[model samples]
Target: MRERAVSGHPDRPGRTPGVTLPSVTERKGTTNESGVRAERQGTAGRLPALAHESPATAFGDYRAAFHSARLPMALLDGDGLIIAANPAFGELLGTDPGRLTSAAAADLADLGSDPRLWTAYREVLCGRSDRLRCTRRLKHPAGQTLWVEVGVEPLPGGERFLLTVADSSDRHDLLARVRHLQMHDPVTRLPNRALFFERLSSALEAASFEPSGTGRIGLCYLDLDGFKAVNDTLGHRVGDRLLSAVAQRLSRCAERTGGRGGDASRGHLVARLGGDEFALLVENSAGTDQVAELAQCALDALQQPFDLAGQRLSVSASIGVVERTAAGTTATGLMQAADTTLYWAKEDGKARWTLFDPERNAHRMTRQALSSTLRPAVDRGEFTLEYQPLVGLGNGRAEGVEALVRWRHPQFGTLAPNRFIALAEENGSIVELGRWVLEAACRQARAWQLERPAARPLFVSVNVAVRQVWDSDLVADVAGILAATELPPELLQLELTESAVMGSAGRPLQALQALSDMGVRIAIDDFGTGYSNLAYLSRLPVSVLKLDGTFVSGFRSQEHPNPADETIVEALVSLAHRLGLTVTAECVESAEQAARLRRIGCDTGQGWLYARPLPPERITALLDADGRTDDF
Candidate 1:
């Protein structure tokens, strides 16, 4: 079989016409030296018999093959005008084959001046590259959008170029749909976490390479307040509807604030991270001021009531806004900071936005780390005990010591009880921690007893939390610890907060009475801080009342004396003594306050005036020195 001879159209005089070749292999990956030759042969063909036959007959055969070929093919002149086109190319442009001839190849669709297309066209026209293949969006005259893969190759015998287009509408559409599903939330229809991270990373990358003004970025991470309660009561259907509504409002807000075209960083992109959490990424942001305005807008939009499931429900959100230059920031760092700030908003009382503060976040992170490490710290014996002397007001002698628990944290050094006690309680680890303190205190007290057998037995008081009283076998634990340490019950006092004792009713009340009857003295710690039930106090077997530090603080300015505080303290002491309960004034920071407490008939005084908290060896030394001083 002779190879098909390609010829140019006679009407378009100096142009080379293209031959129709057989179907060839689809080009995948990239084009190389051999691939370019194959592309020209596959789409245009050889013009071998052009020099052998007459122009008219050769042109006739070329025209016959051009018209007969199944693919959409157009033959362009040196000036990029389509001198001739196969019927398939004409059909693709929604025109007749005769009408398409001599029209500018670009004028067939809206892409005549597209830079990307023209750039490749220039490269082929100027002999810089062999062939150009690109995917373009073309609008057909038949009122349908078409995605076409175009191939531009230099004609073999003239200054003309060959342009072949293959319909890629189905493949492009399928790919686009897959991308949309992956990047979007099905219910809310907002960008999901994956796309948000992608865009954020892209923006950060661009900012890193750009100049100063374009380098700043911002993010606002938000969570709906009380969404769990709504979901639990109304069902998931209503919750989903509520989420959709929120998404719509957020989208509108982003659209209103978003910048157009290439000013992408000045634009807002809202996304749903999952569940009730949502985030907004702001590119090329004007610092936190811009982000703050966006957060306020989001809050206002969510403030409106949602009509879901025939009920009018209103919800508020907590937002954490972060803004910084992209030079040293990362997607993970920004998100973690946003998460931490958002939690601060929830903790500081929700329904508002909070800005990121490094100091506060560090403190919170430390607390969180401590909370997570509490049980393990206990297991590792990282906690130790310190004793504060409880001196008798009459004799100025250290009668007993209150055992305070401290964490010998490897990183933070020794931490006081105030730093981590509430954290322990909140995480339900206080019961175990309290038991450890009790056993340790008992063992220490027995050590002191054996060290000093002649002097009066100095009692040790251990504070117990309300959780420990109710959650554990308090009486049994105390019994076992005492039996193990060989510490007498009378020599170990259990200090319960005023709220703990006053709030005790059924089982807690029983537990307190059982321990009190077992010869464990019960003292009300921080007496006036809570609701002090005077009448209820008589019903319990209470041995002592620890006056709150507030009244002791008043005694510090006794020169310009607060007569009312004096009257209150005096009255409290008189009333407690009448009920057969000893009164111990706490936080006695001055000799004057100590003298005032003694004058007011208070039994014991505990504070910095006597001594700050000390280790066991220091307490023993203080006791020995006091004994030697009494001899003097």
Candidate 2:
């Protein structure tokens, strides 16, 4: 086909007045290496043309294609001013195609809104970058927001650039819906655990970067008390309704408390953390007072009865409140503190809120550290025995000694038995510890007996935990320790707390009987403090009763004496004597207390009045001093 030659505009330079362009089919079949190479070079490649087409006809075809294309397209000059915009581009902005010409391309699509995007856009227009692509949110002239992806590419000539936009609102909306479902709890319609943590982390990060705010964060972690009972009694469907109602109340509480100090914009985030637990996060918290107010509001909200699925139910909640400066706080650390505080609230009694206490938490952490290291401490031989003199009140002489166990901890220094004895029992380490005490005390008693061949040997009394009787072979252990130490069974006294020895049966009963039959003396320490079952004492092989300190504390007063204490002691002594059991008074701090105890027919006394607990060498010195003179 013969094509007409077209004339170019007289105003535009670098164009021939009459030029003929090639046909599209002829350009495609041309074996020109430069054309193929240009096509491979990318968007900046030279434009292919028809062999016999005029410049006007080619330009008209190009304009037709550009206007009819679905993608929004625009042509920008070197100055970033839109020289031409296709119909599709004008429709995207809800404007006329003619009106868009000569406008700044950056201003039309908000390309220069962000500094980074603006820099890249300038780079592409200046031929420094091949292309620039970014997603932008634009406000259309029609009062609608459009999310579009804008692409800027260098034109075939270095002096111009081609800008195209693709509408991404549908894809963005779909993604938003999917994210909303994933981040929310279906039942309560609140943010779930994943979303809560994400927001908390983001808030913390923002606080770190922006130091202008309060720089403090707060959280209220709460659990619904007796919610499990509700789920068990009623169906899970009813329980879910109750949870939704609780969520609504909590949301209202957060809303009410958020308006304080004009912080409604940074309101608390109420989230359901699975099951009956929920969390309220406060970013840029003013102080602990704000957090506390939120917690109290939540408590008050949940206190009202919830009518769920025709079931009227009442439930209380326990909350842990934690507020601290965000500078040193982490999501994990904050959550842990909140969890511990919640436990404290439960322990302090439900239906209340407790703030995080550092001192109490430190003590608990120390206790945990001690518990974890206890069994190993025993193997390391960190325990030692100290002996307190047990004197015969009638003779005024040290008849025996009560063996007290102390832990020479490496980190915590010397710790008394009360600090770790109960911990040992709870972790089942008491059996091992009790065995060590038994063996050590027995060996010491034998050493004392061997040291003093002529004088009366001091019997060693060792404390026994009730767990040892049930958890270990107490009878066999006692016999083995005596045989190993070569200590006479008669010289070893085993002391058990009154409560531990009461209601003895099963293994404990059998162990006590076998030990007594083996000639080991059995003594009940802290006699009157426990069951005080004077009747059951006869059935057991109890050889001695150490009066509790409370009964003996009455003897501390001289000017105003407690006659009732003395009378009670006298009666108990008379009854014990008839049962062939000797009575020992504990905590006899003064001579008057000792004299009164002696006058009441008490056979022995153990207290600071005689001597505080001493090491082995000190006990040996006391024995030597007593042996040389009768002044003891």
Candidate 3:
């Protein structure tokens, strides 16, 4: 068939009026070297062709030249009428190509009133640009809408234009995949830290600026206690699986509270902050009591043991919570405050929840500064260990020396254990510091043995912080320090508080037993201050009980009056002797108190009366003054 040449429009007066050749669609990922494929018969046609059939006929050759033209194509008249289109257009829109008629520019692609697309098209139509590109939503009759990138351009004289639309289906799919990976944790597929913060920021803003709302947010920062043990004792694979299970359980916590409150927009979010630390963000929350309820909910959810790879693992968390308006607040402050509050939870004892208090936060800030400075202080030689001799009441000779920590701050002068031990434990520096103290004290004991060669070596007792035992490798660490110092374990004593020993159930007790079995002695320090289970005291392998300083401090009277206090001390001495444990009275500040303790048959005593705690050098001098040399 002889094709009529494509025509130009009246807008260009001097141009030839006949039809011009049909245009070819650009093909991607195709070898168009061959004259088009038979299947791509008529997908392209000249934009200004006024005769539809001729344009359609010419398009077949254009389509043959570009076989991979996947996007739909169309031609529009000066009035924006659908003049001619290819079969691909109908297939893409799920409509008949022949049935589409030209209408207003807005009517054709449903540009409607959205100026983003309309303005771009008008600019191209007025000959301001040769081409226009835009991303748009095309609503389908089947109720499915697609994201598309449409390119449109004007022909000469502005009589017609070419429109090409690419199905952004693949790009959209790829974006969805990328977004999922970006927002979710690959291990658990739970929303990660970035996404959680994004949501939290938005929630804070909404609560802050949204009118007529109370603007409250509840946050629960939870750290899984004993989680490190699972990783160290088992393996990381098991730990990873446990974290995944934890995420699932936490998700259930968020969902349990997410209910429609007559309006559908408010709820809570749960996210994993990092290893072993997770959080729940509740938006527009109630006050502290309600937040506490949420915490209780989470605790209840975590109460059940996790089944990870054929092993049943148990863990509990310490939660710190705060719920209030986001007014004048920042994301960083919120998280830092939450973390600080969590430290308090752990400090007060784990497996519990504590509400955030500004006063508590101030204390935390001070402690944090102290904790950071502790490591450097050791190198600066700021710490000194003081040994208060424990004298055997029967022989008037030293039986042991209790090593206590003291710091000589350049500005603050001498600061005792009360000032730094808790801070050190919080920051985990206590493990190393405690080891250093142990080694130093044991070496001092060896020195004391050398000086008093004729006398038996006095046992050296060192205090152990509970965190050092829980978080660090207690058994191996103690054993390593003993081996390193070449100090006999029999001469070292590990002193712990009564409360620390009470709740070990089975595990901590097993650990303590391990240390004791290796020949080290165990003593319950500050014995009567805590709820001392005397029933279990005998069962413990402890060798000594130092009565709390409070009991002895109150035992004295202004005159020779408190015989009742002396009688009570006598009863304790009898009770301890019956249990095969030596009882030592602490803070025996006066000769009168020392005489009373001795008269009561107390086995051994530690007090200022026996000579205040001194440095290792002083302790050595004292041993030498006793005038014996390695003669034991």
Candidate 4:
């Protein structure tokens, strides 16, 4: 191949293309109309773009055109020599462009000191490819490194190559930001679900190859207890502030306990699973006890309420901790088990910890599997209704029976509400369950009215979960149920707990009012179980207040010493009466308790002693006897 000399200037040009003029040219004396070659090296102000000029005046216009290019450029010869260099190139390499001539482009690049540069150059010179681009940092004279991306193209005639360089420091920074956003949660800046799984999977692989005796991975799934209470009490804006603060605490704990400070085997990853659920993935755990200890640390850390947006808000977590040698079980199975155990923690009591047990996990799995069938169970007629009689406090006469929901499982025989009501609430199947209870109880009340139509105008009290009240068409469902059973609104009462209406803002309050307006009596069931603000009661359209079983049961228990129970009950009774509210006392087991309740001014009562919740037939027989039973 032939080498072409890059001389576009002609009028004052001292050299011709491929002339190979002698190094010093005693003839030209290193000076001409082109301008005196300085005793020391110097370059014109800017690098020019020669290829864009017309060849006719190319030689005359080269110098002007060369001053406009932004990128540093240089021309390289076949012998790896820098044939010509621009001012920008001189500034980039920290050298005078004139002195750079006859120096190899590799020498000017400063990468010539590295072995890799030689290998890349060798390949480029061999015509393996015409272009080369790479990102590499080179030492500069300023005691700093300059990051650059270079593009090299084979110039026509095969002798010279054009090199263009750009500084990519800013671009590199943007790339880092892009990666972080992809791997972290936008709101909390914690590792997202994607990154957590990646780290977990890697840890698992390492655990498989390592000896079993070494250690294992620990997973702790923590869900914020009563987070919904906070959201319902405050608002989502405050809830978000609380969540961010929680993320900070969790991240700090994860960093402190993940592993050895300087080792990869001890890394921990913490992530938010959306909403109020957060998870921690721990590596290199010694045993179950160690995992439990870590869980305790987490719980203690959350004991201090988070101070956010000027509010001292308390946050507690129910954590399900699981530690396995990563030998027997897989990650998915382990997480599922941990999650199952977490529910047990919440079920046992909020703000607690529970370790995964296979037996408990199996039971929870069965329960979860059964929950999906509950909605369909309603349609299939697998439900039954039982009524417990509500007797008058003074007369001991059965007033009306409260409706209780029971599910008959083909396999489990019969399931109680406590068994599946939580599940139904979680899966939103409670809407159907509530409606069924309504219809069943209303019909039973109608039947009782048929036998004794004037017997105190018997009313059926049906318990409605807060979820149902918030989810279903409450007024419509109750109205339809009563109309269908030919029962009046007064004959079918809806029992709502105090907490259900305490912070009753938004649609829930409106729903309650709508049901109340339909002439259906609304009662606050389990009044004192939830620490409700009693002032809200005066504003509610409630007709009855059922003293919670706990308050009434404490009246006679020797273990508890509280005369306030009776005082509070009497005061509530007085308040109920003053506010035109009837009082229904629950858990009336003994004749003494019933008599005491009546003495305290209770209008109605229900318990095992008042003819336990019986089948429809038992209820009918009682009504037929017309309160003439020998037991009564």
Q: Evaluated with lDDT, which candidate comes out highest?
A: 2
Candidate 3 regions with alpha-carbon error over 4 angstroms: 1-70, 73-91, 95-136, 151-164, 205-214, 231-241, 259-267, 287-290, 307-312, 370-632
TM-score for candidate 3, please give it: 0.49
Winner on TM-score (2 vs 4)? 2
* Model 1 per-residue lDDT tens digits across residues 1-632: 11111222122233221212212343344333324323333333322223345645756657778788889997765545455678898677766665554454554533334556555555565667788887777766566788888887877654557889888999999998999899988889878898889889998998977775568999999999999998899999899999999988887777777632111234688889999999988899988888898899889999999988798999999999999888889999999999999988999999999999989988988999999999999999999999988889998887889999999999999999999999999998999899999999999999988997766778999999998977889999999999999999999899989988895799888988999889999999999889878997888879999999998888887568888888999999999999999999999888899889999899999988888888888877766776221321
Reference-based TM-score of each model: 0.76, 0.85, 0.49, 0.53
Count clashes in each candidate, considering only residues at least 3 apart in sequence or on different chains.
2, 4, 15, 3
Which parts of model 1 have CA positions greater than 4 angstroms off?
Answer: 1-46, 49-67, 72-146, 150-165, 177-189, 227-249, 255-266, 274-276, 304-314, 627-632
lDDT of 1 at 113: 49
Instruction: Identify the leading candidate in terms of TM-score.
Output: 2
lDDT of 4 at 607: 87
lDDT of 1 at 258: 66
Q: In candidate 4, list every pair of residues with a backbone clash.
A: 47-66, 48-66, 259-266
For model 4, how does the per-residue alpha-carbon lDDT over 199-236 read when each residue is reduced to its tens digit?
Answer: 77877888878775355878888899889998998998
> CA lDDT, every prediction?
0.80, 0.82, 0.72, 0.73
Poorly placed runs, candidate 2 (over 4 Å): 1-65, 75-83, 101-104, 115-133, 152-162, 259-265, 627-632
Question: Residue 83: error of model 4 in Å?
Answer: 53
Report how far off residue 268 is in candidate 3 (Å).
3.2
Q: List the candidates ranked by TM-score, beginning with the highest.
A: 2, 1, 4, 3
Please tell me which model should have the higher TM-score, number 3 or number 4: 4
Candidate 4 similarity to native, TM-score: 0.53
